[model samples]
Structures are given as structure tokens and as C-alpha cells.
Target: MNAPEFKKLPGVLAFQRGLVITDALFFNVLKDSQTPVMVVRHGIRGTQNVNKDGDAEKSTAANAKRQEVSNIQTTDTAKLEEEAQALAVRFGLRFLDLKDVLFACAPASTDANDLVRNYRDSVTGFIERAKTSPGLDEVAQRFARNIANGRWLWRNRTIARQVEVHVSVNGTPLASFDALATPLNHFDNITDAERQVAAYIADGLRGDDDAGLDIEARLDFGVRGALEVFPSQNYVEDKPRGFARPLYCLGSPERAGSRNGIEFESTRTMGHAALRDQKIGNALRTIDTWYPSYAEHGRPLPVEPNGASLEAQEFFRDRKTSAFEFARRLNTLDPASPEGMFMIASLIRGGVFSGGKE
Candidate 1:
């Protein structure tokens, strides 16, 4: 397959396999692509602070300490601020503090943090009461669940496009990118799906025949399972952002980890079905190109000789070996034997069975 040309649509930003794309990263992409636009949606975390001159600052050490105590990962405020400012200048873009807009819609006295707390509590309360009042709580429950899980209830045939906003206190709002004065339309006023469609049309975008169908297909792929690898115990926490690895016995204690390879390029699109599926489709094709490259040069084999037993060691010898040989070797071991079971379990845990699992 040939590389897809990045569409040069002004004012409309395009993303490819961008699961971890933060606002800064998005700006960097825009800068790199040299795409010019009249406006952009800029989201920020409430914890960040900004000065009147629009210089972004990090939450104080006190703030970091607070987050640490709460078990939240600490962000490097200085680094983030500098990058944000530099990108804005380089791109000649303006910014709006989206978090402030969310709060502004609340009572004037409400604090930014308090606004988040209020929304959280309200949603939680609605869910608790949903069982007794499905009519009211059902929709609320769906909204809450979507936000909490960052997933669409597409199986339920529901499409709610609620936009969530967060801003850093030290974040400086750029004059060019600010959307506060224009005021974004509230999803509550109309179905989010409608809002998005209208925005697409307003941006001079026409509907593609398979856009929705393709999105559903990708979403289904993600829900079913999108990766061919499983991560080990040592890197359990390092599991790709959107995939989950369930524990199963493999080695003596069952060595836990993914096999197919260290990472699958497609894993990045997991959990973000709301994003354009066309971009993901392109990414999938791009990753598919790797197999031929690997086959030509000979796939690299792991050399770490450690395992629960000799059988497992052999199993890890060179996974690049033909599948027929791999299966035949497993069959030679007795199912009733502990070593046999260990080898079989190791293969299962290492994602040997995940080849066509998706």
C-alpha cells in the first residue's frame, strides 16, 4: 500500500493513531505539518495556572505534592509551559482556556476544582438512583459511563458527543485560539452527534460513504481485542494504554508478558473509537507493512534463556520458527506432565495463542 497523503484542509485538524495526542502534541503536529487554521479547540487541566501575559506556569511544588499524595503522576510544568508557548508563537495561534469555559457555565462563585467535584458528584448520584428510575438515570448513567470509561456505548445504539474540558491554572490563553467569546454550543441543547455533523458540514466537509461504518468496525475490533502481544509481569503496568492483559498461569508461577512483539502499532487506536476511524485504518495498513520487512530480514528471536523449565526454554528458543514445529513440539510434551503444562502455559501467557485472536 502507498502512504496516504495527509489531507490539507485548512482549519480542520487531522490525527492519525493519536491516542496519546495531548494539546501540546497536537500543536506540535500542526507546527510540523505547517497547517494553518482560523481556530482550534484548546483544552487544559484545571490544576495548571497562567499569568495575565499568557505565560504558562506549573502548579507549585505544593500542588505536585498534593497530586503525589493523591497518587497522581506529577507533570513537568516548566517543560510543558515552555513548549506550549513556543508552539503558539511558531504557529501564530491563539488559545482559549476550555476549563474556564466549563466553569464559567457554572455559578460564578464555583471554584474550578469545585466545579469538577460538583459534576462528578452529580453524575455519581444519578447513577446510584438509576436502578429505581431508568427513564431519568438511564441517560445520565450512559453519559456518566461514557465519560468515566472514555468509550461510546455504540452497542447500545446510542451516540452522545459530550465534550469534556479541563484547564491548568498557570496556562496562558492565547488571543488567537480563544473560543470563549464565540461560546461553543452546548451538547445538552442538542444531540452531540448532531452537533458534530453540523460542525463537519460547517467546516465544508462532506460525508464519506463508509465513515460511520468504518468507525463501528474499528470500535468492534478494539472491543474484541486489537493487539497480538501480551505484556509480562515486569511490564504489566506498562501495558499499552488501551489494552488489558488478564493473568493466567504460564511458567512455574506463570511468567506474565506479551509475546507477538514489544508493541503493536495498532494498539494506539484502542479505546478512542470516537476519533476518525479512517486515520486508524491508515495506521493499520502502515503496520501491516512491517511483516514483509520482518520476513525478508528474518524476524529477530529472543535470546534470554531463562524459563520455568527446559521445555519453556526451548519454547523461547526462537519463536520465529515455523508454527507447525512449534505446535508439534508442544504436542510431544504430555499434557498431564508438569513440564508440558508449563510449556503450554508459557506459550499461552506469552501471546502465542493471540496470533488470530483479533
Candidate 2:
């Protein structure tokens, strides 16, 4: 697997997954999955007046935006700033921070509170739209980054040999460690045949003799489903740079809100199918090594006393399990009773079910 020729190549191949449902305001352009539009919210919404310069005095536009941005009453500007950033990150959106543009868009009044609040509310509403909208809107941004960076990486590689990997995601892009990016519930409701195919996917990833097939891939998708054990939610980070979750989902749009990270590792890849297959191995092992270490930084497991219960077993299994094995165990858990089915469904929801149901 250590072929120096294939160590690193150039250029990223990204198969973009667009939003299933566009945001409320941008619905006109975003409704059709095939049709994508760069949603331009109130022009001032993204325009930012601040740069690294400290000496640029405000022109009428700058002064108006400054006045407007400053007028928004908030006890904690830091918190407000963080909110603005989080919204930006969650949606993988670019916040132009055009306080100046906003001023240009409207009349400059000494009282900017009402106008600022209106902008804030607009941003807040966009955040809400991101939480539930089917993915696609945000992944476009990721693809943009990948395309731009991959080209650069390709041009600057150490090897004369070049490689490229094309990937399409099926879930929301939350910061994730593994390829289990499909929503758990989608897997949960599937027929046994689906599980088997999924299991095959897992097996294809970690299978013996499956080595040397460089450029190969196994999708470790994220899941979306009801959380049975903790019945709780995630503690999100809100800032301009990073979010507690992944910024984009790769595959299907319906699975957007799961915010579960899943997609190709990078844009650069090799044309060699064998090389690509082997690369999938590398990606899988990397994910395997990091999932447990990174998944529970500050998060706590919800209290579930019965270790054998669906919630309890899954909590432990998912935490310590491999993507392939997790799928293998699906439906094997006695499917005779309702609890078994629920458990199986939960496993599917957990992105672990990959076996064909008999």
C-alpha cells in the first residue's frame, strides 16, 4: 500500500450534492435539485466593511454600515459576532459582512437598532433554514474550495505522477471522523437487502485481499434518525471560522440536517482504479483510528442503565464499532420482536447496518 508513486497526486474531483430543499427566502432559485443559485440575501447581509486595515476612514457607505452595525443593541457583541459566525459555518455560507453595503442599500439613520435587528433576524432565519433544508446549497461551497485547492495541490505536488479522486456525499457535512455520513434513519427503514448491500460496502472497505486496489473507495456515510438512548441533542459551536458539526453533507439532499460529515477526503487522486481502491483503505483506517478519539471530546452519553437495551448497546457499539462490523450486526439482533426491529432500525439509523436482511 506504500507505493511512493501514488503517495500524493494533484487535482480534486468533487461530485457536488446540492440542497434537497432551498431556504425559505432563496426558495425561488433553490427549489429544483438540478438548478442551483447563489442565494444573494439582502445585499448588505454578506458584505463586510472590515478588512486588516486600521486607517481606512469610512466613506458615506462605510459610515452608514458602521453606524448600522454598531447600532444593533447587544449586551455581548462577542456573542453576537459568534452567532453570526456560527450561522455562516453551519450553512457553509460566506458572510460578506457588508455593513457598508447595507448602509448603501438603505438610508443612514442615527438609530440603526431597528435596521440592524432586521438584518440579524434575517441571518437568524437563514440559520434555521440551514438546519432542516436538504443539503446541496452548502456542499457547493465545499466543492468550490476543493476545486480551487485541488488544482493548486496538483500543480505543487512532489511527484510527476498525478491522481484524482471524485466523491459525492449523501448527508450533511458535519465535522465527522468516519465515512458513516448517511442519516441513520434512512438505513433503519431499509429492507434487509439494503442492509446486506450496505454491509458489502463496509466489507469492501476493510476486506482482506482488498488491498493494493489503489483509488478504491468505501463510503462511511453519516446517519439521520431518532436518538433512542440519550434522546438529546448536540452542543453547537457558533463562530465565524468553525462549527461544532461538519459544514457540509455529501450524498443525498434529504439527509442534510444530520450535519453528519461524509464525503471524499480530498480532490487530488490517481486515475488508477487499483490505486484509488487502495486509497480507500488508507482513508478507512484513518477514519477508524480517529472516530472514538474525536467523537466524544466534551459530549456525555445519556444515562441508560440497561446495557442490552437498543439505546445502551448502540451507544457502546457505535462508539467502539467499525463501520463494516456495525452493518454486519444489523438484523442479526433477534428480529422476532418489536424491540428487535426497533433496535435494527436504530442500528440502521446509526449508519452501521450493511447486511442483507433475510
Leading candidate by TM-score: 2
| Residues 1-358 of candidate 1: C-alpha lDDT, one tens digit per residue | 1112111111211111211111111111122342111111112233323233432245322233232222222111111111121111110111121111111122223233343334334323322332233232222222222222222211211221232222111243211211121122111243343333223212211111111110111011112111121111122554442222322111222223354576322111111012122222212111111121334433222211122122223333333333222322332334333333232222212222211111
Off by more than 4 A, model 2: 1-33, 39-190, 208-358
**lDDT tens digits, residues 1-358, model 2?**
1111111111111111111111111001112221111111111123334443554465323334353432221111000111111110111111111111111122133323343334334323332332232221222222222221222121112121322222222332222211122221111233332332233233222221121111111111122121111001123444323111121112222221333466422122111011121121111211111124224432222111111223224433342243233222322323333223222222212221212222
The TM-scores of all predictions, comma-separated, are 0.15, 0.17
C-alpha lDDT (0 to 100) for residue 41 of candidate 2 = 10
Global Cα lDDT for candidate 1: 0.22
Quote the positional error of residue 258 for candidate 2 in Å.
39
